[model samples]
Every structure is written in structure tokens, then in C-alpha cells.
Target: GDANRAEAALARAEGRIPDALFLIDQARIAFLEHDVSGTEDYWAACRIADEVGSTEIWLDIEVLATPEEHDTWDRLRTLPAADRDACAFFRRFWNRRAAAAGMGVDDRIVAHYQRTRFALDHYRRRGRVRPRFAARLGRPTNSVYDDRGLLYVRMGDPDEVAIHGGSDCIEPNISWAYDRPGGYRIYHLSPLAGVDDWYLQENLAIVYRCGSWDRNPMVAISPLLLDVPGQPFHDLYLSRMGLDPRYARIANHALSLIGDAFAGSRLAEELTVEREWTWQDGEYAISTVPERPAVDLSVDFALEWLQFRAPRPGLTRVWLNGLAEASALQPVEKEGQDVYRVQIVWTLLDETGLFYRFIPSSFDAAVDGPLDDEAGLSLRKSADLPPGTYRWMLAISDANSTADGQGKKVRGGYAGGDVVVRDLGTDLPVLSDVAVSADSVGAWSPTAGISLNPTPARLTGDDGVAFIYYEVYNLTPGGMYETRVVLQPEDGGPSFDLSYPGTAQRSASIVTRGHLRIDLSASSPGRYEMSVTVRDLTSGHVTLPVRTDILVTRD
Candidate 1:
């Protein structure tokens, strides 16, 4: 009702008020009414207003509302108090997150705001606690939410919700379930005696009685004995049975959207509660949060990237590609020709904000692949990045793929770790990271540099050879050097270690390039860590080892 009243007032003074305060209030009112697009409009207006006093007030409230463990909140504290204006930093923070997730800033803000509204609408507690069976609840419970509300804010919505009423055997409680890529995740909340609020519980079970206190309501019984069919209690028991370890293959999964800072603390507390209490499985099983990939693609594919020294000083060049099986792509036939078209978007970010973004590349009608290979398509490109460790993401969309004209779903993913663009201008002996490929290192020459048809997937069937290419810089001229290569099985199986002895014959140059043919006939079918090490024997200097993962499959 208050939001409606505010909207009416704003509508009446629409063009009459151009002040920052008016714009800020309009933005707030729009957000309260779930007008995401309208809110963004007023938000832009407030940013350009000469006087930011009103904007500062709004930002200050948001900063206080955010959890201290949040990445942006923690960083805001480190800034000078004068620069801690939430409005000034909010755009930059969301911009980086959006860039890193391969999405538009407006889209990201809309999603976040919608989630916040959803939490408040569904999880926010309403009235004060009316003491159920005691004179007054012990602890003060004036918070806007209980445990469930706080979790809803941190995590999005649960896939399923179940509420069980108070019974002679068990207390009133609610449970949330998530069907994660790894396995199912469940959380239980129940009110304890003498406590004024709800808390996370470790186990969900129905109680029964036995022996001397069989008739007593306080007597607790073994939960295993209550397994029966066609009963409400039995149905709840069946839900608990789904938490078995065998059903969940493994617990290791990706971090939640909020990262591990706040999630970690909450998980630690849950674990402590588990250890202190008893469960049917001896210990409360706390698995990793559901794998929420920063970027999600509709089709299955692998992302491949390699960093190289740029022609311009202080800049590094990064090569990126997303490879998928040709069968996975739905290319349309146009003008009597097959058209395999895709739109590619690239974004790079550091701790601050958006650094650089490639002009989104799109193909109207392109060839599937080269004449030789038609099994897969390669969407390969390159970008020049300044020397720094940054997070990068690439999103690709099939130009023609759509459902009833509701725009094609973007198909791509982001790197799990930071993309470090090293300063390769130093005079010290240095070697580039090894690049693996299923094909040959096409044509190699001093002036032409080196060409490689790299296998972005880093996979090969058991034909028994992996072609590798790398460059060495600042080496001793006309000196002897030894290049060592090792393909160690990740599961501690046998390793393929070999050394290639060579000499640099050119006295005028210190840079050289080479390729290796490593035999994998003896290697088993599994993932292997391929390490390349180059040592200048004349100066007794060894470059650091560079490693990459390669998967081998038996034909």
C-alpha cells in the first residue's frame, strides 16, 4: 500500500521534478513495485544528476543491508569513507560480475533484484512470536527472517519445499530441496524448545517409544523401526531415505553464486551442529552447494584458451575457442547452402570493473568447417589483453536456433580459474605454455612464426601420438639445450617421459620454436597431466614446468 501511494505521488510530479532526490525516490518506488525496466531508467537518471546527496543515502542503506562477507561489501570497507558511496561502487561491482558471467549489466541487475524481491515476499517473517507453550520466548527474535529467509537471500529458490506440522512424535518443521548437477541437497528448519526462532536441524525423523517409557510422550525411539507404508509419517521417512550416500555419487561441486565466504561460515556451523548431535548415518552429510556455473550453455562443449606474447609491449594475446560436435549444432539451409552461424561475445574483468570486451562477432551464413574435417566446428578467435590476472568469459549463440522466436539461448561457459596474461617482455629465459593438438603444427618458419591446428578439447583417441608445440625465448645463442616432456597419468598410472637433445645453430637469434611427438600407445584410457620443461644446458638454466590436461580414449 505504501509503495502504491509513493507511485501515485511520483506520477503526479513526473516532469515537474528533475532533482536527484526525486529521481532516487522514483527508482526506489519502481524497484518496490517490481518494475525492473522502469527502475533501470530512473537509476540511469540518478547517476547523471549533478547533486548525488540523495543517491548517497540510497547507496548507504544498500551497503548496510548487504552481508559483510559479500565480496563487494568487504571491498567497500577498504575504500576511504568518502569514496564508500554505495551508488558510485554498485555499478562497477555489478558490471564486473556481469562481464565475468557473459551477460549484460541490465540483465544481471534485473535477475538479482528479482531474486531479492522473491526472498522478501516468501521468506520474510511477519508478526512477532506468540509464545507457544512458555511465558515468553527466551531469546529476542526481531530479525526480518529466520534461517530459511537468510538462506533464500544467499541462495536463489529451492527446487522443492515441504512443510511438516507439529505432531506428538515430531516438532513442526520445513524442508528445502535442491536438485544439483552433482546430487540432491536438502536443508531442514525446526523450532527448538526454549528458543524463540527457527534453526537449521541436522536430521528429519519420526519418533516412537519403547520399554519403560513406551507411553511417555518425551521418550525418543529409533527412527529405523518406524518404516511403514501408506502413512503420512512413512511418506516423510521415505524422503529422508533419499539422502543416502549411495544415491549421491560425490559431494564435490562448484561454489555457490555468492562464493564460499558466507557459504563457508554457514556450512561450518552446520557441520558443528552435526558433530554435536546424532543422526541415523552417524554424521550429518553436508555436501557442496549446487554447481551454479557462472555461464551455462544449452549444448555440451569444451572451452579452450592459450596465452601468448603480444606484438605490442605490455599486452598479451589470448586465443579462445569453443568446440562442439557437428551433430550438436543445428545449422539451417539457406540459399541452397548450409549456414552454420554463431554470435560470439567476449568479456574480461579484473578486481575493479570491466576492462575490455570484444565487439560481439556474428556470422550470417558461414561454412561448417574445413574440407578435411566435418565432424566438428571451431569458433576460434583472439583478443589482446594487458598484463594482469583477470576473469574471462565467452558466450556463443546459434544465430538461427530459437524457440517460437523467443531469442536463441546463448550457448557457452566461463573459465573456472583466473586467466593470467604474463609480461613476456623480460630478458630472462622464458618458455611459453605447451599447446596440444590432434592435428599437425601445419607450417613453421622464422618469419611466418608457427601455425597450429590446436585441439581445444585436448582429447585424442588411442591412435598413440599427441602433437605438441611451444616457443622458447631469451635462450643462450648457439648453445646446447634439452627439452624434456612427461605425460603422467592423473590416477598414478605409468608415465611417458622423454627428452629431446638439440642445439641452437643460429648465432644471431635467441628465440626458437619446436614441436614434439609423444607416443601414448602404452598409456591407459584416462586423463593425463602433460608437462613440458626446457633447459639451456650451456647456462645450466631451466625454465619452469608448464602443464596441461589431456584426455585419451580407447578406439
Candidate 2:
């Protein structure tokens, strides 16, 4: 039967009527028929219709959604024509949902469709018949008019259900409750138009209605599980639910559970929480606050660094607040010398706050005497952080210490900072901030290549050469590009240009290096400006040049 309906829809699509509704019908029919590649075909048709400014087609797609979802879709579609691509919008929407669910988009969508079909079959087996009006109009029997069907399609099956009102003249209604791993939801439904078509009620208020209203009656669900951990989504859910005060406590409980679970994971090896009694001596505590100075969205990472003074060798604990995974303290050697360094890598989707604490080991207490001077510890860590402004607190503490002569204990130190992560547009070519390194060590990182050890911007003529490092993104793969670095003296002297021919790779980013040499015997010492430019030879597209100031000192 589905195949026959698909064939009819296909025939209508082939009529060259150029109607958006007909094309969408064809796509939906293909989906119903279990055509594997039909979704892409539907996307192609929608793209063409969008290019032709088919507003009616976009509206038709919105009508297929529940009232709340329809409102969201309509608002997105109302964006400028250039910003509205049906396929891209839908893909992004599904991708975001998948990310929130910690699942893949394709798998999630398939599950949704399968659940929809299962709901239809379930109602059919229960002897629920479609209304005459819906049947005559050729509407799907399990359309949104079927409240259970709609909920099942969006969120799978409910964990529990209850039927109410079987006495007197009162019509019977059903209540569905879901206790999903990600969240909870409750839906109240009643039959409409004296038919088997059930629709969600507007609210708890009892009212007799013949048709559906614009307001969606279903109680909005909030994520309640530890596994689904995105603060942005949680905040959004809270806002949508009118910010109930009780949710704050519930969220805190959930986070604690998540932390407990993470502490048992393999990643938590050698990690132990300090007991309250063991933390009695606070005088010898050390603290460091994490700072996010720069964020690059093009690479989906943020630059986080912190500096601290450790009075004694101790165990360090570092983790992102409200996250399930934490880093285990490992041995770090700098310049063949053992030191305390903490590195944390995070993604844009991760929670913002970072917690770090230090506890002195017994060995340190035996070997190293009371710390008289601060042993400075500085570290640089980078991770992906989505574009947003966040206020975060970095707390550091000394876990090993004794009370002073007066039995007075000191408290741990904390610092707060505002971090703003920016997004670089993908449509245009851009360059990262340039850093000059005298000698780089360690392995290459996504944010900073070659473990750059930055030196002062001043270059003496006797230094021979200075190495510059920068990254370019969104370059056309396989295209020939020219990179030019020029140095101009501040006193209106002639400029020196260093040019290099490069081949753009298939990757979205390219790291570049430039070397500049100054001869004191032949040049005047003054402030100099260094500029870097990249131009694509294939398309003749050029990026806006970036410049840095350098001081050329007399050797």
C-alpha cells in the first residue's frame, strides 16, 4: 500500500507542475515506502524550490510539525533568503538535536521515523479508525492529529500511560508520561471531533473544543540525566519552562550524580577526593585560576592558560564542572626537569567552568621542608569552546598544610574572568594571530603549531633571523596561493618583501612559517611593521592583509 501511494506521488511529481507541495508529498511518500535515499531527494527538491523563492513550500513544511516546532521553523524560515536554505537548515537542526542527545543525526532520524511507523501500527491494532474528514482529505492516518503518534515520532514511546474518565457523561482522556535517559515529558490528550483522532489539550483547564488550537498543550521536557550534559541546552530548557526555581536544585543533584559516576570511570585513575578532616590545615594551600585569553571558533578550540605557585609537590585535580570526564594528573617534565603542569583539552560543546585543586603528597612532606618561597608553575591549555560569553571561576587550593602557631588556617584562592569566544565566518579566508618564536619545542598543537616559545617582538640585527608562525583557514583545496611577508621601516624607508609559493591542501586550514633577517650594517634601527598577505592564484581572491609591529634594535 505504501509503495502504491509512493508511485502515485511520484507520478504527480513527474507531471512538471512545479509545485512545492507536490514535491514534498513525493518525498514523504518515498519515506513512507522506506526508500533509503529519499530524504536526500527531498532535500534537493527543497533547495530548488528555495532558490526559486517558493515561500509556500517552506510554509508547507512548517505545517507538518507540531505547533511549537512549527513556530520555531517559521521563525527560522523568515530569515533573509540568502540565509535560508532548506537543506542546510534542516541538517543543522537535526545535527544540533543529535549533539544534544549524544548520538548521530542519521541514527536519530531513522529511529524517529521507525517510532512513527510503530505508533501507526499500534493504533491500527487497537482498532482506532481515521476520521472521515481526514480520510477524505488523504491525510495520513497517524498524522499530528494523533497526539500519541506525534509524541512517539518526536521522542519515542512513553514509559508509562494512564487512562482517565470512564464514568458519567465525561469523555475519556489519556495521559502519557516519559522517563527517558535524557529527560522527562508528560502529555495529556483527548479525542477531538468525536473521532479517534486525539490531540493535545491546551492546558490543565477543562474545556470542550472541536479542533486543535495554536498553543501546544504538552508540558515541555527538561534534560534530567547525567549523560546528556550541555549547559546551553539546559539553560534553554529552563527558559522555555519559565525558569522554575526548583530546577536549580534538581540540576545540582544531577551534576553531583554525574561527578560521582565519573569518579568511578577509568579516566579517574589515582584521583581521590579529600576528606573534610584531612583538609584541616589550610595555611600551606596553593591556588591557580584558569583564564581563557583567546578563542578561535574556526578550529573549534579555546586558548586557556593559568599560572600558580606551589609551595610543595602535591597531587593536582583538574576537571570541568558539570562534565563527566576529567583529566588524571600525569608526570610532566619541562627541559628535563620534573615540574607540576596541568593541561586540559575541551570542546565547544563542553561546560564552561574549570575546577583545579592541589593536595600535597606524603612523600613531599617527608622530603621537602616547609615551603618558604613559592615554586612558580605556569601552564598553557587549549580546547574547543563554542562562541559565547561566559563568566567562570577558577579555584586553586593547597591540599597539604598545617595550622599556624595560632591554629589559624588559610582558605583557598579563587579568581573570576569573563571569556568571549568568537566565531570566524567560514565563507571568507582568515588568518590567525601571529606569534614570533625564537625556539619552539614539543609537538604541534591545533591552536599553536610547533609548541611556540614566543620571544620579544624586538629583533636585533645580529640575531640572524626571526621565525613567524600563523595559520590560514578556508583556503580553496588544491589551489595555488602566494604568501607574501613584507617589512617596512617606520621612517619611510624602502620595504623588503619575502614571497613564497604554496599549494593549498584538501584540509580547511594551512599553517605557514616565515623567516626575516635584518642586517644592522645596511639598515636603520627603528619601529618596523610586518605584514602578511595570501592570494589565491586560481580565483584571484585575496585575504585582507594582517600586520604586526616589530622593533628593530641596533646590535
Off by over 4 Å in 2: 8-15, 19-26, 33-36, 50-92, 106-144, 169-171, 180-184, 192-195, 201-555
The candidate that wins on TM-score is 1
* Candidate 2 residue lDDT tens string, 1-555: 376866776686676766555666565566666664656655567667754434554443331343444455667667897786566555544443333333334444444455556666754323354433223322234353354565555444444555554222224566555432223344545563345656554321221222123232211211112232234323322321322233344334323434334334421221111111112111001010111111111111112321111112221112122111112112234455433322222222213222211111111111122222322222233333344454443333222322343213222233334554444344566554455433344232324334643333334434534555555556787778888878898988899887878877766544333332324335566777888888877777777777776665544
Instruction: For each of the candidates, give the backbone clash count.
Output: 0, 8
**Ten contiguous residues minimizing lDDT sum, candidate 1:** 247-256
lDDT of 1: 0.55
User: Model 1, range 373-421, lDDT digits (tens) per residue?
Assistant: 3355566677777877876666666665653322123343333446777
| lDDT leader | 1
Give the Cα error of residue 247 in candidate 1, in Å: 11
